[model samples]
Target: MSASSGTTAHAPSRAPWLWIAALALLVIMTRLWMSSAVSWDQNEQLVWSQRLRLGYGPQPPLYTWLQWAVNLVLGPTTLAVGLVKNSLIALTFVFMLLAARQVLPERTAWLATAGLAWLPGIGWQLLRDQTHTVMLTCAIACTWWLVLRHIRSPRPLGFVWIGLAVAWGVLSKYSFVLVAVALLAAALTVPAPRRALLSRGFWLAPLVTVVLVSPHAWWVLEHWDKASGSTLDKLHPADTPSRLHGLATGSGDLLAFLLLAVLPWLLMATYTLGKFWKAPAAPAASADSKHTSSLPWVEPLLRHYAIVVVGALALMVLAGASKFDGRWIQPLLLMAPLWALSRWPQAGNNARGARRYLTACLTILVLMCAIAMLAPLRDAQRGNGDRLNWQLDAIAASLRNAGFDGHGVILAEHHTTGGVLHMLFPQAKVVVCDADDPGFHLGCAWRKAERARAKGLPLLQVSTETPAPDAWWWAAWPIGSMPECQIHNLPYRWTDPAQAQMQLEFIVYPADTSAPVSAPVAARPTLHASAHSHLQ
Candidate 1:
């Protein structure tokens, strides 16, 4: 098909929005229907959402804050978490489509948006378990669209919006700083973006970002060690004999992760488009040069992205960092589809090719939805234990039978279990004994537990197994003797009664009516290595 004919055939329409909405709804419904038990990351959010705070563990507060707001209305059910997650995912697509349309033909723009479904991290991981990364993806997509729009037509108001988007990005995840800096560097390499950056209104962008990010910035300053500790641990070299060895390992890991995250879309696009890498035929004198130059932003965007990735790898090697997660590179490569299509616009000019590409993308998404829906049943049949297979309802029932009474405090060994318990018993205060920071006890749940104990309210301790004598909870609140523990082996949620069962142990410490009412301990005990290892 000719370029004009292809553009007309796949003209801009509301069809893309409908597809995005449908996908979002499907994910939200699938999650609600799958199981009530939360995944590891979702449990972490539930634990953090118990109370509002400026910072929560190593990550920023944007996601947890949003979860708190959703839970306020939805009452801490799976629907609240699913709604927060899938809504951001929907926005990610919306922003990506808007950005693509700024430079590519409308049909090609839709292709790029659909193409995101081919990326494993965005298509599967986000739908399955990711939390903070989802919010960061949405913020990054918005920032990219706003920046591209400003490049097409600079306005003071546009700069202000850019600032707001950048602020949102940083609040979503600290790694967004790298993306923001790399994007600014990339824009400077291009003439139009450079001129736009030089515009007088550009100052508003930074000003707005600083104002919006300052409150959380202060909280980070006060709790720098707690906020950055986990991230540093992940980046720390794993007992390498030499820095050179660490560098080699870290570089290889970073590259492998980047490729895995983008290769599916890249390879599929190349195969489907036939000549995805071939240079386009020369434009005729009658061709509008203005329309050709509309795609000027893609070159710098891809170039700076490469520079940033290389620079990050080099820095990680120097710091002896030997580990990387696929999600870490998600924001950097989120625009891979757009870059691929823009590099060879002619490849996308064929109407038949576009149809096949969209069909493939839709097929992959459908498969992803199917996998998500049936994963629990598959695990049950195989007798494989996973988050979905957890029998949280049975566990909660057993605890109630032991006299929990839906009041007072429940101390859980791990954050995951704590979050599930919190969801089951929303009226009671739930605390993860394993999640306490060594230097600063930021978890208000701990204090609430102490006050509840002093008030002679029921206090229950729950764990997957019996806690060791020296467990962290013992040190936090010293009990005179180990209470009578009950062990229950309940069958997995969907598994047959004959299959392997989930083991749960709990100790119900009835109300301490004998102790005199007094203020809880002024200082918390230092976190022990055993508890730390259990958390890891």
Candidate 2:
């Protein structure tokens, strides 16, 4: 064999693991630097993490429980919460590394693994949003690796891991069921992996998964509306014309988003496969022998990815899903390189292509890290009042000044404020009245607040406002309806006029149990009545 061919045939002596280590460290450091405040999703996650229940809001309890554990160790600072998410993101790449090593040579494996980190969906959306989907993404990556391991070397432990991972992924998000379906399809159709279906260990997997997720499944059964409402809300059927229109728009948008999500990897994949299509056929292997030989494990893995991604779009088109979020497929993006190289096996041996791919990924990774580091500083300097710079400390102090001693129920008109208050004052009662949950009236813990109100414990009422606010003006009535209210319009101290032209107001109402709580006093401004009507 020639020198370059020889290099492709064997693993390199020098370790590429150190490079992965450095990238992992960079991921953590960027997260810590970006961890000044929680985003809308992070703050919302805090609401779910308030307890270790089997279910929270629309999603399962695992991610929140994971956050709860992280909070226990690191405390609930933004950095600690962010670290939990960033660590999961790191594990995703690690799992990808393991999966890639199963199908390709060491150098190609490293390239594929590192390349996943730069996929716009994985690198940008997953890292920035840090949603429950992050956990699902990690679980899927692990499942892929474990499934490949079992197929490559049929072990019972691998099946156990696949079960555990699928369970974890399902617990993280219901959308993960798509990935499970993909895996099942792989097992059913692929010849070598098809043998796993008959294995006793394979049969044991579903039982293990069921046992692992039974508590949350039970919770979903008990609280169907709360658990499934958000998901169902998006799946409404459309009329024929509407469905056709949505099908065209949604498919086009989904394709665009998918392309953007996969980015340069998709481009690289297309380029590599194009070369494969153009290359002259090798006449080495006999036609019958080549046709009969077992397909590479990567083939079925790619099928799983296609079934989840393309099959999902097909179903959505059939169901008339009006819109699609690219982040929905973020978990599957890791399989892009595998799918590409599987279609064109010889492409994995292209040393020049491998170097170019790694370089592009590194460039994107560094550029993103720099942007993450600088964006917040710029926002803070501009006083944008984005979550990273939200003045939670000031809000806490304002509550104290209003005679809230971290006791009784504290009421806020918005989940953002309520969630932040809950995190800041763990002992105090924070009630958010803005939940879409049918069971929740004002917000979660409404019943708890009602009992406290009956007992006449003070309910510290607070509401925030911006200069040119939209629908948020209506939030005040629910909190304002309390009896004997004193309103304080405190200036929002978080941002400069240059950063944001918004001032937050706090209205502190003392709950007097001696008097019955009635409707808002007629003496109050007509704006209150107008706001109440809007809510109705």
Candidate number of the best lDDT? 1
- Candidates' lDDT values, in order? 0.76, 0.64
Backbone clash pairs for candidate 2 read: 382-499, 383-499, 433-442
Instruction: For residues 144-198, write the lDDT of model 2, one tens digit per residue.
Output: 8888667667767777787898899999888888888877776777666777555
Worst 10 residues of 1 by lDDT: 527-536
> Mind sharing the TM-score for model 2?
0.81
Candidate 1 local lDDT, residue 213:
89
Q: Write candidate 1's Cα lDDT for 10-80 as tens digits.
A: 44689999999998888888888888778778888998998998888788898999999999999988788
